[model samples]
Target: DVKVTQSSRYLVKRTGEKVFLECVQDMDHENMFWYRQDPGLGLRLIYFSYDVKMKEKGDIPEGYSVSREKKERFSLILESASTNQTSMYLCASTSGTATANTGELFFGEGSRLTVL
Candidate 1:
């Protein structure tokens, strides 16, 4: 089974602090994604990397960034944590477009961030 492991299940940060959320997948998937899920907005993509050292911005990439130096690992960085960025963050990965790019996304349990 493809498993995505997120570093934290919950976190608390102050405004302007830099935050890092790590994700690791054992499946060696080519595509990995970072997303933030909110109450009514559903899941909004923050960033995604299709290959090592390659990155792409998603719909809402304002306060977020990603790094994928290795096939099995990816990290999301918050340049400056803020109250508005508080939300449930999810990390996911797929075997790339061939498997099912638009299929159900395999998500981590999610990391809840609270900024004050």
Candidate 2:
């Protein structure tokens, strides 16, 4: 089974602080993604890494960045946390194989961040 683990379930920080959200996957999937969920914005992709050391900026990457140092690990970095950035962050992984190519994503519970 593919399992995605997040470092924190909830976080509270002040404005302008640097924040790091870590994600690890048990499966050696070739694709990993980071998304932020807002009340009405739905799930907006922040970043994604298809291979180690290779990353692509998603739709909303202005305040976010990503790192894929290993095949099973992907990290999201908030350079300067802000109140507007408060949202539920999700981590997902896909095998990109034929059998598992149902266009489904195995996601982590989520990391909710609150900036005050």
Candidate 3:
């Protein structure tokens, strides 16, 4: 069984503060992704890393960045937090490239961020 664990399930930060969201995958998945979930917008990809020490900007990468130092861990960094950035962040991982890199994604519970 595969499991994705988020370091923090909930977080509250003030504007202009630096926020770090960490994720870990038990399975040796080659790919990891960070996504932000909002009411109407659905899941918007923030960033993704296909390999360690490599990252690719996703749909919404304006106020976000990612780091993949090791194969099992990926971290999302918010350089300057803002109210507009408050949302539920999800971390997902896939074992391998199953049909165009769209394998069965195992997701974490989610980290709900509220920027005040």
Candidate 4:
């Protein structure tokens, strides 16, 4: 079965601290994405990658960065965390296969980060 695992289900950090959120997929999907879910904003994309070593900024890329060094793993980096950055972060992936017309995404449980 395909699975996406997030490194943490809950996290807490203080202001000006660095945070790392990791996600891994066993399905070997070609596309991976990072999103933050807030009460009003819904799911907002923070970053995404189509292949290993390649990344693109999403809707809200400020205060965030990404790394895709391997095919199965992706990491989101917060250089200096702040209260504004606290939220539920999600990691997802897609097969990107030609035969699969559905742009379905497999998602991890999610990691909630709290900044004080």
Which 10 residues in a row give candidate 1 its minimum summed lDDT? 96-105
TM-score of 4: 0.94
Model 3 misplaced stretches (Cα beyond 4 Å)? 97-101
Candidate 1 accuracy as lDDT: 0.90
All predictions: root-mean-square deviation over Cα? Answer: 1.6, 2.1, 1.3, 1.7
Estimate the overall C-alpha local distance difference test score of candidate 3: 0.94
For model 2 the local lDDT of residue 27 reads 83
TM-scores for every candidate against the unseen true structure: 0.93, 0.93, 0.95, 0.94
* Better structure of 1 and 4 per lDDT: 4
Q: Please, what are the lDDT tens digits per residue for candidate 1 over residues 1-116?
A: 76889999999999999999999988878889999999999999999988999999999999888889999899999999999999999999877665534755677889999999
lDDT of 2 by residue, 14-102 (tens): 99999999999998898899999999889999999888999999999998888889999999999999999999999999877346355
Better of 1 and 2 by lDDT: 2
True lDDT of residue 48, candidate 4: 94
Best by lDDT: 4
**Error at 107, model 2, angstroms:** 0.3
**Candidate 1 to truth, TM:** 0.93
Clash tally, candidates in order: 0, 0, 0, 0
